[model samples]
Target: MTANLNLYSCDLTDISLSIETILQVVRESKGIDILINNAGIGKFALAEDLELDHWNRVLTLNLTIPFLLTKYVLPHMKRQNFGRLIHITSDADHIGFAEGSLYCASKFGLRGFADSVRQELKGTPITVTTIGPGRVDTFFNGKKPGDRPISLNADDVADQVMHVLSQGQRCEIERIYLKSTFE
Candidate 1:
């Protein structure tokens, strides 16, 4: 069976436009049932060496965008009474790396936001979950999938996402962390 999918591309950092687009999509689709906040960019540099512009860009994309998206999508979810909000965070949320100050901060904030939202929706059918994966084989950081033997394959993380989505309304997961066994 073919899945019904509608693809959209936009600069998520453009806050107003992004929110408008999201709302339009929800209206066009009739309602929103799930939201996955996965757009992120990593600008790795020592704290002192990282430019202010890069820091702001990283924070905007990695943190602010997700929050804004969630803010907009939540009302539809609440109205629907059954919805899932998933965030693709990073292990940086747990451990800070030397050159990943900006990335780590954003990811950490994402996890916190998800956790808080989860609590806020405790009695509701809406569920919030954050997935933290360590070094996935993807185009992130100018790296290819096969570049890091110690990295988790993108499919591995997707499988976990599927698991979260497959759960019943009675199951609300808070977090899922994926790491290569070698790490």
Candidate 2:
């Protein structure tokens, strides 16, 4: 399916810093029916070796960006009486892995963020959802498509998102946790 695309490359961390720019961008889009907060980064290093920059980058991208985007989009969603905020977190949100202390911290924070936001939006038509998927075969980790064994494919992830988007107005899905299995 083909859809209209709006691409902006400004620093999400600076999104708040430049409120005018963000508001202008938001104005350009006008409004959003569905927001997929999928931008994230992983700095795979032990706690000691993890630099402050890496830690901040991961936390800002994984945790803070979603919050900011959600904040910006909710008003539009509220105005329309409908919206879906989907956070593409990772299994790290649920369980911490070795050399992933910083990564896990960011994801765990996202889990908490979703939990609180979902409750806050209970009476509204806006729905907050967090999808935590196990290792996926993507370019993020230097893996080529279809080259990994039994890892979640990109399309599978998209299908799951589409499922949420297809839900009726009365339905509210809180969370989806997917695990990869060897097949």
Candidate 3:
């Protein structure tokens, strides 16, 4: 927590374009210790009506971006022998919905990717985890607080992330599935 926080603005989906920034960060700081793949985009569309462009866009942002970010930071983390990579997937990852085919596909792919990466990094100090909240009030969904289908607060999700990180080097929390009390 004492390390200086640095923010670099760029389109994560375009990893090739932004990799130099990561290279620079690693060059300057020696290595990275934490990575949070929390960026995602969602647009509900039926399988029949889902366009190829939209499908690619959704998948690129939700799935591809996380993988790329994880790719660049991995070597640094491995050299340091300590790191954490967390992906913010969704309940859709486990359950498919009629009109949410694209969104579900992206999330499901992400979940699978996270699982594989976790196994790949087993012997190292790096850990891969996913926080799948049932639904949230973020821009991801149009739901308001206390809406018909209950949703978890964004802060609550962040809290869970902190809880996972607080476990320190002693625990390896694979994934956390959060649900609304109503669910």
Candidate 4:
């Protein structure tokens, strides 16, 4: 039988709700073998002009929620000796843009967190991977014109995820960064 898929669509800014939803999935499902943390939000504003609420919302979803979800899922993954975590980060984590202080901070923190967790999971089948992509044409920050004609598509990221999953248990890819050719 196919494992049950419990999809939770909520404002990821709600930490309590996010944690509760993940806990519910863990409790109801037979087990969780993979987790794809693809949820994130961003705001473009000068660091000085950035609103506190916007920063909090971005950090909560892009950072804390992932950490909490990983914390709750680790036991299941450790028990089964098998798990895959794919974190969707951004190239901005490595570089910086004029109005991306909050976004970059959150993503950078997430990448660091993923790396530390991967190190701690050595010798275990639980794998942690962070995938960073440049200017994907998504409604991530509201729809916009295809500024970069050669920007990576969302499918490109999906293919990366599939590639990671296809790898043997002995292989663990830690990080992948995809950048747009135009930039």
Candidate 5:
């Protein structure tokens, strides 16, 4: 039978609601085969001029939400003995970007979090992977490929995710970094 899928459109910054929703889903669902922590937000602001609220919002969505969701899902995954978690990070997690201090910090934090959890889940069927893309041409900033010629398309990242999931049960791809050929 195909695994049930539920897509939640709640804001990640709302911790209480997000955590509650995650717990409720896992508690009610039969099993969670995979959890993709893809929710994220970006903000363009210099470190010196960054607003506190903006930083919090970006960090909340990019970092804390994934952590909370993973925390709630771990028990279910552990019991089932099979799970895959993918955190959609960014190249900025390694290479800092100008005017993107908040975004970089949040993504970097997510990368670290995923790494730690991957290690913690060692010897278990629950595998964690982090996919970092350079620049995806999405509605992230309400921009299109015509508006930003060098950006990669969202499908590029989606394909990578699918490929990772297609790997054999005995194999696990830890990380993937996709960049635009033109960049």
Candidate 6:
């Protein structure tokens, strides 16, 4: 399937480019059955020290990009009455940390966006789910997999994504929170 998969590289931060990317996918695929907004970037800084450009960049990738993608794909989903919108958020969406004001704001906004859109699509086949994981063991922020014992494996979250996708048609998973236990 990798041989048949076509990937288009675009700067998602650029609204025009992002829209074009989505349009291209829709045109090639006929219609979008699922959308996973998994791309994100984090710039950690105290609220007082965060610059406007940094804040805008974080919000653009974490919140605005997802919103735009959803907006573009939603019409097709609504037309077909079937779609799955998945947004990979962070535990920062639920709680704020010392130097994560910008990150938290963007994540929190995404969580809220998922919730509101879910409501709007209620009674439809389309489902909006948010998977918020805590301290995933990835290269995020230059942290390695085993850098923190309390961090979760990337596979852990992938399992949750599969779980959400495997649910029965009658079942609607609104949100899921994942965190690693420190033993």
Backbone clashes in model 2, listed as residue pairs: none
- Summing lDDT over every window of 10 consecutive residues in candidate 3, give the lowest-scoring window: 140-149
lDDT of 5 by residue, 89-129 (tens): 99988888789889999988999999999999898878889
- Quote each prediction's TM-score: 0.94, 0.87, 0.90, 0.92, 0.93, 0.92
Q: Identify the superior model by TM-score, candidate 1 or candidate 4.
A: 1
Q: Model 5: how far is 83 from its true place, Å?
A: 0.4
Clashing pairs in 6: none
Weakest 10 consecutive residues of candidate 2 by summed lDDT: 13-22
Residue-level lDDT of model 6, residues 1-183, one tens digit each, is: 353556778898897899899888877875677888988899997799989999988899999999999998999998887889999998888899899989999999999999999999989999999999988878888787678757798899999989988987688888899888862
**What Cα-based lDDT does every candidate model obtain?**
0.89, 0.82, 0.84, 0.89, 0.87, 0.89
Best-fitting candidate, measured by lDDT?
A: 1
Q: Which is better, 5 or 6, measured by TM-score?
A: 5
CA-RMSD of model 3: 2.1
Give the range of the ten consecutive residues with the poorest summed lDDT in model 1.
Answer: 23-32
RMSD of 2: 2.7
lDDT of 4: 0.89
Q: Number of backbone collisions per candidate, in order?
A: 0, 0, 0, 0, 0, 0
**lDDT of candidate 4 over 24-50, digit per residue (tens):** 877977778998889999998999999
lDDT of 4 at 71: 93
Supply the global lDDT for candidate 6.
Answer: 0.89
Pairs that clash in candidate 5: none
TM-score of 1: 0.94
Better of 3 and 6 by lDDT: 6
